[model samples]
Target chain A: MARMKFLCDAERCIECNSCVTACKNEHEVPWGVNRRRVVTLNDGVPGEKSISVACMHCTDAPCAAVCPVDCFYTTDDGIVLHDKDLCIGCGYCFYACPFGAPQYPQQSAFGVRGKMDKCTFCAGGPLADNSNKEYEKYGRNRIAEGKLPLCAEMCSTKALLAGDGDMIADIYRQRVLKRGGRPQTWGWESAYGASG
Target chain B: MKTLVSTMAGLTLLFLGGCYESPNVTTYEPGVYKGPKDPLMMGKADQRAETLKKRFELVQMDR
Candidate 1:
């Protein structure tokens, strides 16, 4: 099994929001909902770090645990996804998720929360691969086409990485070795825990 | 005597009924996924991983 995961290199990230733009463009994600965003720590400081934030698609997802409707499912590649039709817009997953990955769209004038949406790792949802219906509901099915997420692919600085866990970790390890420094893989420990 | 016997039988039934168990309800299991299966899982995962490995080597390894 691949165990697909996302890793953001804080040292490499320049907070350009290219990943964010790439995600929005690729998915046509709604106005209020951002599937991916860059968060910068210690703003205005010279040594500040920025990292791209989204669902880590954890080995053991907290959102899945807290969902009342049990709509969440993990793909064979370890991508965390939920059926929008099954989601009740309860916002439990939002609270449970450590990375704040679960997002609800406010489509109506009343500001009523829509179904929960989160990062799917570009694997799409529980629908036919590359179908129009699936695209309408869950955006692109790039994983089915053997492609990684566009957010990572379009990243100019290669700060955001999406792929198999072990492979990406090896890549990061190599980067660290070359750079000769200990750099944090931000949110990995909380999302995936120590063993992951 | 008949009244006493009826009371005893009723008590015994009540006691046995207290011990009767009902069928377990089938709710969603914790940590188990209850949603529809994804399309990506339908293909050969090993082949997919291999393809991804090649991609990583191409784009990520040298960077």
Candidate 2:
């Protein structure tokens, strides 16, 4: 089975924030919660590189490791998912996650963080595939329809690539090879002179 | 493996002793997930031509 993955090619990324918007709109994610975000390395700089960030769904997820309730589970495709029913809203996953992917909706009166929510890789939850219940909590199941993550699909520059790991690695590698080397990366000309 | 073997043995003994009417245990094979298909898988790809076409369509995205 293909190890499902996402790779944002910094070279092609334009920091459009389309991926973020796509995620929110598709999932109807609650207010004050962003499943995906754009992080630019050098703010306001001419040659800044930005990559859309979210739950990387690591091989051995730290969130799973730290979750006291054991809500987290990884799919065969390596997409990490959590059961809201099993979650205790403890925020341990939040602290354990390296990318700050876990989010809690501000629903309670006294600033109580609600159930942990994060990027589901557009795969929804443990419920039946493409079910309305799954859609209510998670987002659309584009994967069920044989499509990639909506974030990657909505990417204007095709910079945010999502699919099997090996396939995307090859794509990114070919792009690099096509450019002849890594020095001619994105914004290289804007950062330095256009002499190669 | 030892724990699993012991658990299975205990379950078998319980069944044989008639103390356990119906066990709700679910034994799963290793290296496979048998949960509800949330975001189900598409069948595998056959060749690069399809990939190239898909990439082209995405790259042509004007939005």
Candidate 3:
């Protein structure tokens, strides 16, 4: 199975936030609970750019590592999912995640966070494939349906790309070669560690 | 019995004082977002552009 991934082209991203709206509409994500968002750097600056941010579905996901009940799991396609039932409302995943992907409802009076939620890469969760349980917990199983993530598909500038890692990397490489740009050195190294 | 009660009380105070250290990686500096050129010593302009290109590739592959 091909490892799934997401790539956001900062150069091409107009920060239109079409991807963010598409994801929210597709998932019915509650207010204050955005599964995807556009983060702008150097807002109002001449060279400002916006990059759509969400779960990268990393190979060595930090959230998965810190989950107390082993709620998190990775699929053959490289999507990271979790068992909501098994979650214990711990916020370790939230603190550990570099992308700020994990989110929890403020259900408790003392601010005891609720079960963690994040991007499922549109593949849903540990619940049975395409079952009502899965849909109820994780918006949709688009990957199982052989469909790409709604965010990437709805991207206005085609700035957000998602799919097989090799293919995505190649596409990015081509763009860089064409534009005479160099690779970023911070995020992947800091989040995943230099060894990666 | 008195000593035991005092010890318990002390422990409770320590725990309830929000002094319990978390096991999670606490080295993270919240509200401090890092950019591509922030560390790794790469050229700022080129790094940002490259990072964007990488992100684009990921999205494109799924297409």
Q: Which predicted model would earn the best TM-score?
A: 1
Question: For residues A1-196, could you state the per-residue lDDT of candidate 1 as single tens digits?
Answer: 7788899888889999998998888888988889988999888988888999999998888888888878988777788888998889989999988899888899777878999887888888998998998898889988777788888887788888888888888888988998997764446774698799
Q: Which pairs clash (backbone N, Cα, C closer than 3 Å) in model 1? A: none
Q: Ranking by DockQ, best first?
A: 1, 2, 3
**Tens-digit per-residue lDDT, A1-196, candidate 2:** 5566778888788888989988999999989999999988777988777888999989888888887766777866788988887777999989999999999999879989888999998778888778899899887876655566888877778889877777777787888788777744346685676884
Give each model's whole-structure lDDT: 0.85, 0.77, 0.72
For model 2, the local distance difference test gives: 0.77
TM-scores, chain B, all models? 0.53, 0.29, 0.29
Q: After superposition, how far is residue A6 of candidate 1 from its true place, in Å?
A: 0.9
In terms of DockQ, the best-performing candidate is: 1
> For candidate 2, what is the recovered fraction of reference interface contacts?
0.16
Predicted candidate 3 versus true structure: per-residue lDDT over A29-120, tens digit per residue: 76677788899877998877788898999999888777666777666556777777778878898899889888887775888877777888
Model 3 misplaced regions, further than 4 Å? A183-196, B1-63
lDDT of 2 at A105: 95
